[model samples]
Target: MNGSVFSSCLEASLQGQAILNDNGEFLFVNRAFCEHVGYTKEELLLLSIESFVIYEANEDLMKKEPIIKRGMQQKQVEKLILHGNGYLQTTLFTVTDVSDLNQGYYHVQLDKIVTTFDDVDFSMLESKLRDRDEVRLPKKILDGIKDTIITIRLDGQFLYANEAAEKLFNRSMEELLSNDFWTYLKQNNDEELLSKFYQLLAGEEYTQFEVYKKDQDEWFDVRAYRSDDQVTLYFINISNRKKMEKELKESEMNYRSLVEKSPETISVHNGKEIIYINPAGKKLFGIRSFSEGALNLSEIVVAQDQARMRENYRMLLTGKKEMTNSVYTLKRLDGKKFDAEATTTLITFKGKPAFRTILKDLSERKKVDDLIRKSDKLSVVAQLAAGVAHEIRNPLTTVKGFLQLFQKEQEVKPFYLSLVMEELERVEAIIYEYLTLAKPNVESVFSKIDIQVLLEQILTLTKAQSNMNNVTLEFEYEQVPAIYGLEKQLKQVFINLLRNAIEALTDKGTIHVRILKHPDNQVCIQVEDNGCGIPSERIDRLGEPFYSTKEKGTGLGLMVCYKIIEHHNGVLNIYSEAGKGTTLEVILPASN
Candidate 1:
C-alpha cells in the first residue's frame, strides 16, 4: 500500500498501533499509540520505539530482534514504557514483520495495558512464534544498502552479513557469516586490517581506514564502530575515486615536467615570494635551488624596474589585466645583470591567485641589436666621408691659398689673417661634427634639448652632402619649446632624415626642413624632399628592417632612426604620393 492509505488504516484503528522501520524508527503512529506514549504524532514520528522503552526492557527486546528479523513474530511481550512526564507503564506489545506492506516496516500492536504483573505468564509470552511466511524486513533493508555492512561478536565471530558484503566477498550470506572476522583478515594476509579490528575490539570505540581488496581488485573505505558486545563495519567502495586521484596526480606531474623542461625561464610567484622556479629560471639566476632562503621577487629584478614589475604583477593577480609584456634588467645571485623580456600572466597556483612570469633572455639579442645600430651608424658615416672631405678640403684650400699669399709678401695682413683663421675654424667644426657620428656610445643620458639648435647643427653637417647631390637644404622654424630626449640620438634621427632626403633626389632638388610647436605641447619637425618621390604603398615599408627604396640600401639606418625616435616617446610618420615629394614628420612631447 502507498504511505497515505497505510497511514489512514493505522490511524483508524481503535487499539494503539504503530509502524516502524527495521531500525525501530516510527514511520506511522495511530492516535491510540500517541496517547499511550504521551507524545503527538509529529513528536513520536521523530523518535524510535526504543525512545520510550526503559533500558532493561530495551535490552531484552534487542535480544529478540535477531529472531524477529529471521521471520518470527513475538506476541504478548511485556515491556515497560516510560512516558514523557516521568512516569512508566507496563504494556504488552505484539510485533509482527510487515515488510509485505512496506520494504522494511514492522507493525506493532498495543495488545493491552496490564494493571497487575500476575495477569500474564512471562514464561509462555517470552517464547517466539515461528511463521515461515513472515517477511524478513531487516535483511531486505540491509541488502538494499549500497555499502557493505557486517556485524561481528567481540570474539571475532561474524553474526550478520548484508548482500553487499556477500557480493564484495563473492560468497553467500551463510558462508560469509560462518567465517570469523579475524580469520578473514588472516586469510587475506591483511595484517593491517587485523590490527585495526583488534584496536576496535580493545575499547577503541571507533576506527576508520581504507583497504584494497586484491581478489576483487577494488578499493574500499572501511569504518568500524564498536559496542559492548559487537563491532559493526561499513565498507564503501572507492575504486573510481582512487583511479581518478591517480590520473589527476599523473596529470599534475606531467604539467610540472613540461614547465620544468621549458627552454625559457618560467617562474611562479605570489606578491611576496617566489613559489616555484623552473630549472631554466634557476640557471638564469645562478642558483641551484631556493633552499638558501625565501626568494623575494625584488632580489632578482633590478632596482630600477622592480617598481614597474610589481605593479604589473599586482594587476595580473588581481585580474585587472590579462597579461603584460615588458623588458627588464635582472640580476643573478652573483650580481651579474642581464636583460630579459618578461611576460606576466594571471593564473591559479595551488588554488590561490598568483602570477606566472616567463622570461626570455634578451642579452644576446641586445648585443646583436647594438652591433647592428653601430654598424648602421658607421655605414652612414662612411657615406658622408666623401662629402665631409670635400667640405673640409674647400676650407683647407682657402686657408692654404691665404698662407701662400702671406708667404709671398712675407707680411701678415689683418684682413688676410682673419680670413685664414676663419677658414681653419670652419675645417675644425667639420671634423668635430664628423667625429661625433663615428664615436660609439653604448648608452646615452636624456635631457632637455633646444630642437631648433639641434636641427641647425644637423643642417650644417648635411649641407655638404646636399650640395654634393646637387640638392638645396632649406631650414624654417618658429620658436618652440625644448623637448626631453637624448641629444646624440636625436642628432642621429635628424641626420638620417636629411641624408635620405639628399639621396632621394635624381637631380637638383630643394629639401625643406621645418620645426615648430604643435597644438598639444609637442614639437613637430618635418623633412620634405622635392625629389623622386616614394610610391604611396612603399612609404609604409620605409622604416622596416632590410627594406629600402634605394637598390644598395640595407634600410637598417631608417629603422634605427625609427627606434631612436620611439625610444624618446616620439612618432615618425610618412606622407607620400607617387609623383609628388614625400614629407617625413616627427612629433616629440615638449619638456616642462
Candidate 2:
C-alpha cells in the first residue's frame, strides 16, 4: 500500500494504528495513534518504538527485546507508554506477521488494560454460557465484564443490562428496561458532564464522571463510551471508598477539635520519649516547655507502673493491641503522687507508631466517695438505735412492774412467780432478737415452734398501727405441724411483714394472712393485701438494701425479713400488680 494514502485512511479509522520496521522504528502513524500517544504525526515518526515504549525503571533491556519480535505472546503485556505530555498511558499492542517484509502493522488500544485476559479461553467460556438459539456476543461480552455494564439508546432508553447493573440498581432487567436511564439520575449543573453525556451516542467523545443513584444512597464512578447503536456505561461501585474518604476528612477535623478542647489530660508518647502533650496534659503534669527530649515517660509514670507502661508501649509498637485503660498513681513534675485514671490508645503520629494517653484525676472523686461511705455507716447506726429503743421499751416496763408487785407482796404464790418469769423471759427474748439482728453470726438452735402462735404475736404487735390506719387484718389457718426454725428470727420476720402490710393501706383495706399445710410436707404462709401494690418492674429489686419506695424508710426491713427466711431454707415468693394488691407467699419445710 502507498504510505501516505494508508496513513490518511488510518487517520480516519476508529482504532489507533501504527506501522513499524523490523528495527522497531516507526515509519507511518495515524491521527488516532498520535492522539493515543499524545503526539503529532511528524514528531511521532521521528522516534523509535523501543525508545518511546516504557519499561519499568531499571528494567533489563534483554528481557523486553522479544516483545515486538514476530511470534511472542509475551508481547501481550500492559504497555504503559509515555505520552508526549509526560503522562503514562496504558496501551495494548497486537502485531501482524508482516515482519517477513521487515515491517509490521500494530494495532494500539488505549482506554483499558486487557492484557490480563490474553491467556483466558474466551471461546470455551462463551460456548458454555451462550444459548444455542441466540447469537448474543455483545450480551456475553457485556456480562463477562466485572464492572457494572449497561447500554442505553440515544433517547436514554435501556437497550441491554448486565447482572452487575441490575444489582447496583436493585432491580431486574425487566424492571430496568421499563424505565428510561435518566430516571435514575438527577440533573447536575456541570456543563462539561452534560455535554459529554449528550455526545455519548456519537462514539467520538469518551468521558468519565461520578454520579449518585437516585433510588439508592450510593455513588458510582461512571465511564461512558459509544458503540454501534448504543452508549455503554461502565459503573464502579465506589460508594464505600468515597464515603470513607469523606468520613476520614471529617474525622480528622472532629478529632483535632476534640483533642484540643478535651478536659481529660491527653498526651502522646513514642516508646520512652514524649512526642505531643495537649494543653490539659501539660498543665496537669506541670510541663512548662516542649523540648523534644525533655519529657521522659518513665519520669511521669510511678515507679510501680513504669514496668507495665513499658510492656504496653511495646505492644502498641508491634500492633498487638490498640488501646488500654488503667488506674495508676502517677507523679507530677514536682514529684507529688496523685491517683490518675489513664486511657492509652495506639495511634500514628508523624507517620510513626505512638501511644496517646488521656488521664483523669481521681483525687476529688475518691474523697467524695470516702465521705459518702462514712455518712452511710452513721445513718445505719442511728436507725438501729431508734428501732431497739422503740421495740424493747414496753417489754422492759412490763417486767419491771411485775417485779415491783412481787417485792410488795411478802409471800408470793407460784402463779405470781410464773407471771414474773414470763414477763422477764419476754424481755430477755427481745434482747436476744436485737443482738441476732445486729450480728447474724449468732448460733442457731432450731426447735419445733407453733407457727400459729408466731403469726398471732406479730399481728398483736402491729394491731395499734393497723387500727390507727383503719386497716382490717384477717387470718385463716389449721393447727398446722410445727415448723423447725429459730423462734426469735421467725418472729422478727413476721413482725416486719405485718408492719409493711399495715403501711401499704392508704385508707380502709383488708389484709388476709393465711397459713396452710402444703401437700409436700411444706408449710406455706400467704400474706395477701388489698392496698397500694408494688409495680411489676421493681418487684425483683424489692429486697435490695437501701432501695426503698417510702420516704424516711430504710429498705433494710424487707432485706432482713428475706435473710431470716433464707436461713430456714424457705422460699419467699412475691407476686404483685400495680393497680391490684400484692401476695407474698412463704413456703418452708415442716418438721416431723
Candidate 3:
C-alpha cells in the first residue's frame, strides 16, 4: 500500500488514529487523533506516543520498547490522553502492528472517549460511524480502568459496573448487578452517600467529595454526575495525598497547642495592628480578643511611648532589625499603665511578615524593688538603735550632772553652763543622723553632693556596727567634684554598701572605702573588703532580690543599693573571687 493512501484511509476513520514506529515515535497521526487530545497535527508529529499516552495499568510506556519491537498488539486497553489544556480524558486504546502497510510502523486507535456523555449527540455519533465495519469494543475497555466506575438508574437501580467497581464493592458482578445501589447503601447505613446519590437525581450537575474506607484502609476522591437519565460515579484513590494532608494538620495542631499554653504573653502584630495574641497575652492586656480593633499599638501603648513602640514594630516588620529588646509603658484595657519588656522578632504569620513580641510585665518586680528599698532603710535604723541609744545616754548624763552643779551653786557659772549646752547639742546631732536614715520616703530633690563628705557621714553611722563586727572601716578620697543627685538616697546607698561589707567579715577584716575622680569627670566610689569572698556564679547575681552570699543575709541591702545607684545614673560593678576579697565599684557622673 502507498503511504499517502494509507494515511488518507486512516484519516477517514471515525475514531482517532495514529501510527508509530517500533521506537514509539509518531510517524503519522490523523486529524481525529489531534482533536481527541486537543493538539494540532503538526504538534502531535513532533511528539512521541509516550508523550500523550498514560496507561491505566501505571506501566511506563518508555520502558516498553522491547515489547513494541516484538510486534505486541494491545487491545481495548484504558488510557488517559493528555489534553492541550492540561487535563486528562479517559479513552479506550488499541494498537496493532501494521508492518504490511508500512514497514516498522504500527497503527493505533483511540475510541469510547468518556467525556460529558450526557451532552453527547448520539445521532451525530451514529452518522459518523455509519461507514465503519466494526462495532464498539466490549466491556474490556472499561474493565481495564483503575478508577471505579458505576452507572445507576434514576430510581437507584444498578445499571452497570466495571471490573474495578467489583473490587471496590467487594462483590461479584452477578451480585452487584442484581441489587439496587440505594438499597445496598441504606443497608450499609451510609446516609451521606445515599443523600449525595439522591441529590444527583434531583438535577444537580455533579457532586464531588472525599470518602474514607476504613476496611480497605484507603481514601477515595469521588465524583458523581448525571449521565442521560442515570448517574455515573467515579472513585479515584487519593489515600497518599490525604495522609500527607492529615500529617500537616496534626503538625499545625501541635504548634497551636504550644502557643496557646505558653505562660509568656506572645502576640503577632502586622505593622498596623495586632493580628494574633495568645491566651497569656489576652490576660496580660486585659482584653478578650485581638480582633477587638482596640489592639492597635497607639491604643495599647502609653501616649508617651507610642512613637517608640511603633518604630520598634516597624523595624521588626520591615526586617530592618532581626530582633529587638526594649521596655515600653503599655496601657491595659482598664486604662492603667504598666511597664513591660517587649522582646520582638520577625516572623512569617499567615504567609506575611509580622512581629512576634513576648511581653514580660515589670510592675510586680518594680513593686518588690521599692519595698526592698524601704525595708533595707528600716533594717538599718533597727541595727543602729543600740548605738544611737548609748551615744545619746552619755550626753544626757553629762547634761544632767551639769544641771545638778548649777542647782548646787547659788550663782550660775558661764563655763559650766556652756559645757551643759555642748552636751545637749551632741545628743541632738546623734538623733539627727538616726532620723535621716530612718526616713521612709525616697527624696527626689537633686543637689550638688560632695561624695567624700557623704561617704564620711555613712562611715560615721556604720562605725559602731563595724566595731561590734570586729571589722575596721576606713575612708580615703581625692578632691572629686560634687555629684548631682538625691542626697538622702545616696546616703542610703553607701550606708547599705558599708553595712554589707561589715557583715561579710567572719573575723577581723578591713573595709577600705575610696573615692576617685576620673579625667572624664566620672566619680568612682570603691568599697573593698578582705572578708570571705563571693563565688563566681553568685557574683553576677549579687544585687538580685533574695540572693545573697551571706547565709543569714536578706540580700535586700545590696538590692536597695543597686536601685538607688541606678537612679543616680551610675553603674555598680562587683569584682570578687572565692577565698579572696570582694570589691564593689560604683561609677557615677559628676556635676558639670
Candidate 4:
C-alpha cells in the first residue's frame, strides 16, 4: 500500500491510536485518538497519557510492563478513562509495544467501549487443558454425589465408579474395574444405549435421558458428557418425581373435564385480565374461537356496566368480597349486545389468587321482552287506523280524480299536476296498506303456476324501478314443471320483495333473482341483493307487520308477502350481514 493511503486509513480507523515514547508521553496521535479525548492533534501531544487515565493498575504511567512488550499479540486489559466531556468511559485497551512504531515510539490502541470484561482467546485456554492427560475426579468428590457416576469407554470398559454406582452394580470397586459395564446389567442391555455410546465417542455432543435400572427396580436420569479423552456418565434416581408428575397429569385431566362439561360459561381472571376461558365460555360471549377474544374483561363489557364490572372484579380479587352475581349486557366481537348474568367467586388458581366467573346468556329472554313491547305498539296503531281509515277514503278518492283530470289538460302546468298526483297516490297506497293490515283480503286464484314465468313477469315489472334507482336487476333461471298456487298472489309476493331489494340499495348495485327446481318436484325461488343487509338482531323482525328498515316503510308489505307465501304452502328464510347483502330463499313444493 502507498504510504499516504496507509496514513489516511490509520487516521480514519475506528480504534483510537497514538504513538508514545518509552516515557508514555504522546509523540504523535491519530484523528480518532484526538477525538477520543475531545482534543485536537496538536493539543494531544502537549497532554500526557496520565491526564486521560482514570484508573491505572501500575500507578506509574512511564513504567515499562513486561507483559506489554513480551507478548507478540495485542494485550487487552480492563481500562477506564475520562471522556472528552468529563464523564468516565469503560473501554477495552489493546496495547502494542512496537519498538519502532514511528521513530521508535510504542503504539497504544483503545478499541470499542463494551460493558463486558476484557476479551481473551478461550481456545488457547482450552488447548492447555487438553495438552495434559486425564484429570481425575477426586475420591472425596466422587463419594459425595448422590447420583451413580461412572467413567466408561465405547467398549463398555469401566475405568472408574462412584459409591452409588458400586451399590447399584452390587459389586466392589476391585471387581468392577476394567470390566465391561454392560455385563453387570440386569435390565437395560438394549442396542439403543450402545448406539448412543458410539455416537458420543464419535464427537456428536453431550446427551441426557432416563433409563431403567436392571439390578434395582427404579428409573434414573442419565447424563453423558465428554471430559478430556474420557466420557463421564452420571445417573440420578427420578422414580419418585416421575410418579408425582403422572398423578398431577391425572388431576389436570379431571379438572379439564369438569370445565368443558359445565353448561354455564366458565372463565378465570386475575384482576381485570382474563387468563383462561373454556369452550362454553367462548360461546357464551357469542364467539366461536376465543383467539380473537379480548384479553381483558373490559373489552366485552358494555360501556354503562364497565365501571361496575371493574368494581366487581376488584372486589372479588381482594379478600373484601367472596361472591357476586350481577346482570350485565355483554357485547360480542360483531358489536351485538346480549344480556348475561355473571357470577364471580374468588378462588385459588395456579398457586395464586384469581376470580372465577360463570356467565349465563340471556338473549332468549331479551327477545321475549321485545315481543311484548312490539305487540303493545301494534295494538295502539291498529285501533287508530281502523277508526279513521273509512272516514278519509271517500274524500281522498275525489281529490285524486280531480288531479288526474288536470294532469291531462293542455292549459294546466303538467309539472305541478304530476307532483299532486304523486302525493295523492302515496296517500292512496298507505290507505290501502292500512286497510289490508286491518283485514287482509287476497283473491283465491289458484292455478298450476310456472315459477320461472312468474319471476320473469315480476322482473319486468321491477326493472324500470331498479333502473331509476341506478340498481341493476340480474336474473338466473333453471326451468321446471309448474306448481299449484295463487299466481297473482305469488306475483304480488315477488313484486314487494324485488322492490324492497331495489330500495335497500344505497348506490349502484345488483338484485339477483334465481329460480331453480329440485328432483323431488319442489321449486326454489331465491332473491339475493347487494344492498345494506339487516343486522343479526333485527333479522327475525324482517317480515313482521308494522316494522321496516326503510324510512317511510309501513312493514305491511313484507307481512302480506309472508301471508301470501303461507297460503301457497311455501317457506321463507332470510340470511344477511350488516353492509354486505341479504339472501331470501323460498322453497315451494312442485306439482304434476
Top-TM-score structure, candidate number: 1
**lDDT of each structure?**
0.76, 0.71, 0.74, 0.71
Q: Which stretches of candidate 3 lie over 4 Å from their true place?
A: 1-147, 152-164, 173-180, 212-219, 237-263, 288-294, 303-323, 373-592
- Roughly what TM-score does model 2 have, to 2 decimal places? 0.29
**What tens-digit string does per-residue lDDT give for candidate 2 at 303-359?**
556544655555566665577666778889999989998888888788977788888
Q: Candidate 1: misplaced stretches above 4 Å?
A: 1-142, 291-293, 314-321, 368-592
Model 3 root mean square deviation, Cα atoms = 16.1
Q: In model 1, what is the error at residue 282, expressed in angstroms? A: 1.8
Q: What is the C-alpha RMSD of each candidate to the true structure, in Å?
A: 16.4, 23.8, 16.1, 20.3
Which lDDT tens digits does candidate 4 get at residues 472-575? 88889886778888776678788988888888887799988998864346677899998999998998788776578988676778888776676665667687
lDDT of 3 by residue, 193-221 (tens): 87777677678979998887877999999
Model 1: lDDT equals 0.76
Residue-pair clashes per prediction, in order, are 0, 0, 0, 1
Lowest lDDT 10-residue stretch of candidate 2: 128-137
Task: Provide the TM-score for each candidate, comma-separated.
Answer: 0.48, 0.29, 0.43, 0.38
lDDT of 1 by residue, 434-508 (tens): 454344344677788999989999999988888888898889999998888889878988998888888888788
54 in model 1: Cα distance from truth in Å? 15
